[model samples]
Target: MKHPTSYRTSIIGRTAGRLGVLTAACLTALAVAAPAEASTFSYPGHGVAVVHDRATTHADRAHPDQYRDSFAIHELGAVFGLGADNRATAVSAGCSASHPCRSIALSFQIVTMAGSHVRINATNLGRAVNEQCPGCQTLAGAYQFIVSTPAPFSLDAQARNQLAVIHHRLDALQTSNASIDDIKQRADALAAQVKTILDRAAAAAPKDREVNPLGTTGPSVTMHRHFDGPS
Candidate 1:
């Protein structure tokens, strides 16, 4: 019994009314779940070590020094993980009494422990049988290290909202003529609330990284935030 055009208009109005309700719901949800400002973490620098080998003479081979050169990566508190890369280059050639001076073949091992120090060991072939040429058969190598860091600190909508409420309360207190003691007590309570909020955020943040080479836990990265109550 309805006109075709009027029926279409009625249907259109109902559809638009439903769409408007859905849009309002979405906007309210977005506002309530608004995200906090963006944040990022700080990354530590990489570790490195370089070595220059000393020439081993045939006679000196009789009493070879067992100890190798090593270096440590300090300030590891922020480092979470590490990767090591090493390479060696032949520096010189040495001649023995029986053979002509030739480049000596060298092999090395880069050892990293759970801690920061890295040990570099160059293989000692054998005692030289004849008088050896000086400064021959030496190599130079370097160890480059890569480090991983933690994620940055950030707050979610809930934390931001909690902070905002605390801010408003503090602002009201600041403008009030309440007793100094009462103000101090309220301020202290607010500061405690702030600490609790920050502590929860930190607990949920990224933890320390485990470095493969270190074979143990790396240094801990922590954010130190202070909340001072009203004096």
Candidate 2:
């Protein structure tokens, strides 16, 4: 009779060194997946030239004006009677160190104006702008507000929510052991849902009416998106 070969019942070929490396890798992956950073987004372009497409949460005064429109918040310009006008509405008294200033993205109807301050319907709150001209008023007033264009719900928020759902479904499909047909079916459904979401978001996106190109007329909002899954 041949002698039985010896073999350990434990994990085969997984030495202490290998185990340590595996554990370290798993920990690193977990660390990297702490949380998803909010994706930065901006609304449809003005149909002519480039559009303002960024927002800031942190306060910084890199420029001399300190608290000026900077067109950083061009939407705010529309609120101040800039309103799809081909020419920029100039502000005589820009936010300087002496004047003190701040700008914020708004998602509400501008009901009225109190000097440089504007009253919005959303949350019954008002914010101040850097307009020194007392007699100037918005030609488009409520319609000038971006939020008013897509009143009630923000298209950005809706798009983000749909994206989150799509991501979750994709993650599930990745880890699944379903058959080929099942996979294809699920994928098709997801694709349809994605198309619907995009249609809605595009419909909801804001437009500048006629902000650029002086007098040339063009299409309204043009909502566009791209996906670069997993950082």
Best by lDDT: 1
**8-108 in candidate 2: lDDT tens per residue?**
11110100001011133433333333332111111122111111221111112232111111111122222211111111111223334553322221111
Q: How much lDDT does candidate 1 score?
A: 0.29
Cα displacement (Å) at residue 89, model 2: 51
lDDT of candidates 1 onward, in order: 0.29, 0.26
lDDT (Cα, tens digit) per residue for candidate 1, span 92-168:
22344443322211111111122233222222221222234453323222222222223323345786677567655
Error of 1 at 231 (Å): 9.2
- The C-alpha RMSD in Å for every predicted model, in order, reads 32.6, 28.1
Cα TM-score per model? 0.29, 0.27
Which ranges of candidate 2 are over 4 A from the true structure? 1-155, 211-231
